[model samples]
Target: AQILQLLRDLVSERDTALILITHDLGVVAGMCERVNVMYAGMFMETGSADALFARPRHPYTLGLLQSVPRLDAGRRQELQPIPGAPRNMLSPPTECPFAPRCRFEVEESRQAVPPLEELESGHHVRCFNPVPAEEWQRTRVGAA
Candidate 1:
């Protein structure tokens, strides 16, 4: 916590940029202004931290958020682990790396890689079948 505070202070005081790379979403939420979610060396999503947390468009991004345990969540709430093993880096697949584990996978997702498409201003996602806006909005409301 102290280190994070120091980093934050440096960014504010010096007016410099900091590139933080970690698997800790909590830290990302606290420290980052913008976030780029990656899978198998490819960027799955990129957007403002607040926007991404509130409404993750890509399946991998959603899975990552779901896998994190929330402080306000009930004791009985379980983390939804992303199903299936990670893709082999040695022999990367031509299709979307997250397709195998993604619950929202569609036929096109398996045939080719999806290009990063901007859904809203500054919010981009590399997915053929992104999570519906209504679905994410509902989840956000429920979580709140």
Candidate 2:
């Protein structure tokens, strides 16, 4: 493990950028400085991996985080799953894309797409009525 860490450190000492595509958020948390979160060919958020994980602004990013089990979390704590299935690429959407199954979607969301806006600094969300962080917490507790 020490040898492997040394090799990783040596690689990071270079100017080369390594793009790792994986569902392993733990790996990203440990080794990555930046993160690009994407869904349905659209970017949900992009920024420092640590900052994003610490206080996720996008509902999608929150969902992704919720789905990952944490060693620090209690054993009785059940990880939340990402809601809804992926849209069929064969039959693309015409609205906010995620409106169909999004809990925070409004009528307008189903009729029009919303641009990704910078909520704060590097955090951005492509939602007109994103679920509030408080509401998300309630929903998780209720579901559990």
Candidate 3:
């Protein structure tokens, strides 16, 4: 991808910062030491790629990961995309904007919008009812 090449060039040039905004997680995984996953004009999660992708704490983040397809050790592969389009960001919005598409959304989620919280050291997510690790694992199992 062009972005990847650019990032490589930037690193080669010893740039201090090269801010890139993109939807490609593969690019993040490849070139970024850290990443911030944003949605509807807000960051849902921000942390090192190793920590965030290795263990996503937010439902929105989990959903984003689930949307991407990965190769299995014993199988051939095709990329899987996230189900549903991103939420429309009108000039103004209310409540948990991603609720409509988030399977984990609950009654409490509808009551208020949550700001980012520090779920773990250096890992932040913007959901009041963050998914526990086991539940996230179960979701992947069910999807499998």
Global lDDT scores for all candidate models: 0.90, 0.72, 0.74
Q: Which stretches of candidate 1 lie over 4 Å from their true place?
A: 141-144
Best by TM-score: 1
User: Taking the tens digit of each residue's C-alpha lDDT, what string does model 1 give over 1-144?
Assistant: 999999999999999999999999989988999999999999999999999999999988888887887778889988778899998889868898899898899999999999999999999999999999887876652386
* Clashing pairs in model 2, backbone N/Cα/C closer than 3 A: none
Q: Using Cα atoms with residue i matched to residue i, what is each candidate's TM-score against the true structure?
A: 0.93, 0.77, 0.79
Could you list the CA RMSD of all candidates, in the order they appear? 1.6, 3.9, 3.5
User: What number of backbone clashes does candidate 1 have, counting pairs of residues 3 or more apart or in separate chains?
Assistant: 0
On lDDT, the leading prediction is 1
Against the true structure, candidate 1 reaches a TM-score of 0.93
Write down the lDDT that model 1 would get: 0.90
What's the ranking of the predictions by lDDT, best on top?
1, 3, 2
**lDDT per residue (tens digit) for residues 1-144 in model 3:** 785787688788996776678777777778787889888888888998888777787777787777676554225654445557766676545677777777778887787778888888888998877778887765552245
Pairs clashing within candidate 3? none
The predicted structure with the larger TM-score, 2 or 3, is: 3
User: Model 2: per-residue lDDT, tens digit, 1-144?
Assistant: 485476577777985666778788767776677888887788767778866776665667777877877666688988778778878867656887666656667888888777888777876778787657675564432234
